[model samples]
Target: MERVRITDDGFTTLFSTEFNQYYHSVRGALDETQRVYIELGLLAKMQETNEINILEIGFGTGLNALVTALEAQKNNLTVQYTTLEPFPISEEDVSSLNYQTGAETDLLQKLHHVKWHENIEISPNFSLQKVNCTLQEFKTSQLFDVVYYDAFAPSSQPELWTVETFTHVASFLKKGGFLTTYCSKTVVRRAMEQAGFKVEKHIGIWGKREVVRAIKL
Candidate 1:
């Protein structure tokens, strides 16, 4: 079972008693996604091409995908977003989220309502394909331009942070593609480097001191 907690930054986040962790930062969930994933990962590459392909490591509450979809619609950018999640949250939890306001709540609902394992056009420019599987079990011939590495923390799920896993995930990226994550540990950076990514640390959001952006060079 999951519970909701209002963080210091005035946003609601899901707390998983199973993992003993929150799905997003305790400071703020919406702010974190916008700062780390949309601003740094998606918008940074928006000017380079009109169409962008994005892969998210953990779909979780679909917050990252929702913001990306809104941005895509706003900027008239075409986006192909593919996300992987082994276990999805319940609809009750999704409905209880306080992320959006007024009419925007409808958009959030539609995001979660879309069926998995098939491509769904969220808007004229944004398309989503939610894969109901873990990264270890996910396989695809398609290459992505950006990867949102939003998995659980290394302390909780150490296996997902291994060099072999990063290398395998990196194989799905096109040349010059980048992966961003909230983790900035030296060991995690080194693992990304060993997996053939040129790693760089950037100022993090809210509670985090720094984040990493790794490029496939």
Candidate 2:
């Protein structure tokens, strides 16, 4: 079963009993995502090109995609977002968490309800494809400019965090692409490095002292 959890900043996150994990850090879901994925991952990529392709490892509650769509509209940048989720959360669990109000709630609903494996325009500037498969199982011709490595923690799902998996995930990125994650573990950084990324660590907003940001140059 999954339940809604309120973080320190008052935004909501999902806690999974099956994995005994929270979808995001308990410190704050919105704040952490904005700082890690949006600022470090997407906006950093936007500095180089207006049109970008993004690949995400986990869809979870679709919060990352939701905020990225909003950013795309806000900055008037074009974004192609592809996300992989082996198991989607239930609709009841999705409705329980309130990330935004008014039209954005509807936007979130659309993100959740959209059909898997089909590219659909979510807004004028943002298009999305939700793939119902694991990162290991996902095969695509698309190359992404940035990757949001939001899989469950290594402790919970060690398989997803392995060196072999990172290599496959790295293959999905175009040259000079970025892969950002909320984890700063040495083993994680080493895996990314071995997978052909130039790794760096930056101070994070919550959950840990620093996070990993890898470039595919």
Candidate 3:
């Protein structure tokens, strides 16, 4: 896939035609991640728990992972984060996506050099493991506390949005655990319901009308 830079909401955003839309926007993309997904959903759940184990479906641009790590650092929350990326981007490509001005270069380096295939502690409370494999092939013996289902739009990769794959993911989520997605399609909502999740429509960000947040019941 080819990456192109575009200006969206005052931020220089990067996107691949393979995945629709911009990577992020200055005005609202980061806000969407921080407010809707992280704050209202993920962090809210973590507040009631002593520790959290997060599984991210698509580690695109490493934005969600970074935010999670930063939150763990700030809140002294213990986190075990596992991220999956089938078509992982190169280090240079990730570096180019750091459009946020004044961001520490060390975070970028840490992001690029993080060990893959094994759990590595980046801090006392934050540990990360990257699996360089597609979702269909990965195997896990543990259930997660939360899941960030940030795959490409359903139209771009329908297979990942199917009930079958979601069922597979459900096997790895503890009872009462939550999964958040930026998609609100009928098929996707139905798939989550079929996978035994209690699905609900959530407030969307960045000019979006709706999103989906589900809890495994």
Candidate 4:
């Protein structure tokens, strides 16, 4: 059975039964996401253009998408976010995730309830399309300004950490687009580099020491 696991940062994340791991860092779910995907990936792209198109590999708990939507509304930026998830969390579990209260909680509800494969505008600045498929099965001619490579760890899903998978995902990026992930393992970094990215290591807090933001030049 699945359950909610509270991280060290007071926020809660779910333990994936299929993957047998926590969705986000055990130290802090919200903190880790804000640091990695938002800071290293989305915000960097936003500095260049107010309009952004984001491609996320996993829609696990919708935290990444929720945070992105909040940022877009706050900055008055336009965002088109697409996420891929093969096995979505059930509604009961989604409601149980204690991220925040009031409007933030409501926003999270909107994110989970939005119909899949159809673009829905959550706010004036943010639009989302959730695809219920794994990255290997995802197909689209569209390219994105940035990618949030928030998949399970290499230990949980080794197949996804290979050069071939990185190369396949790279095709989803537009020219100059970069992919940011919470993993900076030597083997993973090498795979990303071999897949044609200029990988850079960023200092990370919590359990992991470093994260990576790889650019496709």
* TM-scores, one per candidate: 0.96, 0.96, 0.89, 0.96
Candidate 1 error regions (>4 Å): 206-208
lDDT of 4 by residue, 1-217 (tens): 4478888888888988888888988888999989899999888998899999999999989899988988888888999999998889999888878865565668888899999999999888999999999888989999999999999999999999999999998888987898999999999999998999999999886545899899997
Candidate 1 minimal-lDDT segment of 10 residues: 96-105
Q: Which of the two candidates, 1 or 3, achieves a greater lDDT against the reference?
A: 1
Badly placed stretches (over 4 Å) of model 3 are 1-12, 24-27, 99-104, 206-208
RMSD of 3: 2.5
Q: How does candidate 1 score on lDDT?
A: 0.89
Least accurate stretch of 10 residues (summed lDDT) in model 4? 96-105
Could you tally the backbone clashes for each prediction? 0, 0, 0, 0
C-alpha RMSD by candidate, in order = 1.6, 1.5, 2.5, 1.5
**lDDT values for all models:** 0.89, 0.89, 0.77, 0.89
Candidate 2 per-residue C-alpha lDDT over 1-217 given as tens digits, one digit per residue, 9 for 90 to 100: 4377788889899988878899988898999899899999999989999999999999998889999999999899999999999989998988887876575658888899899989999888999999999888899888899999998899999898878998998887998999999988999888888889899999899545798789986
lDDT of 3 by residue, 134-155 (tens): 8999899988989888877777
Candidate 2 local lDDT, residue 32: 88
